[model samples]
Target: MGMTTDPFSLLGLEPTAALDPAVVRQVFQERAAAVHPDHGADAADRAERTALFASLNEAQRCLSSTPQRLRVLLQVRYPELAASHAGAVMDGAFMELFGAVGAALEKAKAVQSRRAGVVSALARAMLMADETMAADAVMGALGAVNDAMGALERALPALDETMRSGEACGPQLKAAAARAGFLEKWQAQLRAAHAGAVG
Candidate 1:
């Protein structure tokens, strides 16, 4: 199998969004060991094993993340539906969460800006209170984002059950993938902001 091979098939997993990341990692490790280039007998065999190992690495990377796994599963199972839902709008709850994260990030930026403008140690010390407040806000916002991500992860089992039951859940899978993508992005942003606020 090459890079374009189905990731679930490459990783020996059933195509479902409810996969546990730890299980995927374990499976990938086992498969990678079997195909490892170090076990190759000759030059040509080493090259072939190297390629296969690379493909396995790609598969593991895609399947180890909830968003990427969902996208891969959707594209493999419902290409047309996945393409159609590419630009689907996030629902109201995500919008609200996005707003909160945005606000926290802005506050952190403001604190960073003020801290940078202060050249004197006394001035910088004076700004510590505001920085602490900003840090607290960022931590709170990060907690909210984490909670939202957890909720999405908790819903994956039900989505898997729906698919297993032979119902059409491409739309739901697409929506969850979209939300996971946003949450992952926001989580990174919030983490960076928190670091800046505290640092």
Candidate 2:
């Protein structure tokens, strides 16, 4: 769970800097086979197997991709990575890249919330609010998420400075962490909506 430890190591694999998704999958499958509940007939091995299976799943899922892996690693080991990257003051090139990404995320949130709010409001209107008003509320929540993400982004430079300069307690980092929490929830809702649409 901590970034200091390689997730691959948890699965009994060397924590290599280079990625091999196939190898990771192979290790996970092997580990899970040894510990899965299907092997629980043997009481002595059941608990251990279950624990190993769970850990295998976590390691596989978390390390399967760069963003998820990075996010997981940062949230665990380098949470300071979030704040410093979000609010730090930097040269034009870095700032431009950060700003562009922030803008894209905001745009995505706006579009998703607009579409989701329409459906959510239609479903919730009987709760006393009109359809239009309900939709607006949903969109408003999306905007709030976007704003929080933006603030989180803004704090990256400051977070980096604080972490790099060895400033232990960073207000910018705290704010960015809070914003990341909000963003996670918002992103989840969006994902659920997307899944529902797909289904």
Candidate 3:
């Protein structure tokens, strides 16, 4: 509606980290339909519509996740603070867990890759036990990652509360963002490992 970079404004949403997914979806659908190129008047209008559509998609993506939404808000509301916050580090324990999960994923991948090259049934059978073990290890890693994510999610409300109250400085948000990134990456690796084991 307005030529602004504020994602919430672009998405026709109230500027808050706590967003309802349903509302975001509904608004995006309505706006996207309204700006569909088929409904544009001319080439110029179509170009503008295309840009708006892209912006709307980006806005929806940014608002759909807690950490991403927080990051966007920080960039918009406190650019200087956010710049400094970039150097913030995640907890040492979280980093340790992430490292362990990554190592497990690599081990699983190595087993899966080795199994892929085995042509003979006997050779494949010989590797089945190792494959099974690797899969089990991946599951164990996934469980640990999930546990860590659960703890982080549980603490998110407190962080949100502090941010809302202006009590949380930049580092707090930065740390949460960093942890979220690590958790997201770990979960993705776990998914890939699980899929490899399954298929």
Could you tell me every candidate's TM-score relative to the true structure?
A: 0.95, 0.43, 0.84
Tens digits of per-residue lDDT for model 1, 29-76: 999999899999999999999999999998988888888988998888
Lowest lDDT sum, 10 consecutive residues, model 1, at 82-91
Q: lDDT of model 1 at residue 131?
A: 92
Write one digit per residue (lDDT tens) for candidate 3, span 103-184. Answer: 7888788888897799999998888887788888888888888888778767766766777787745667666666766777
Q: Which regions of candidate 1 are displaced past 4 Å?
A: none
Candidate 3 matches the true fold with a TM-score of: 0.84
lDDT of 2 by residue, 54-131 (tens): 777878977765335435535544556654655433446434544544544454445445456555654544432333
Report how far residue 19 has shifted in candidate 1, in Å: 0.9
Per-residue lDDT, model 3, residue 37, is 74
Report lDDT per candidate.
0.89, 0.54, 0.76
Report the C-alpha displacement of residue 37, candidate 2, in angstroms.
Answer: 2.1
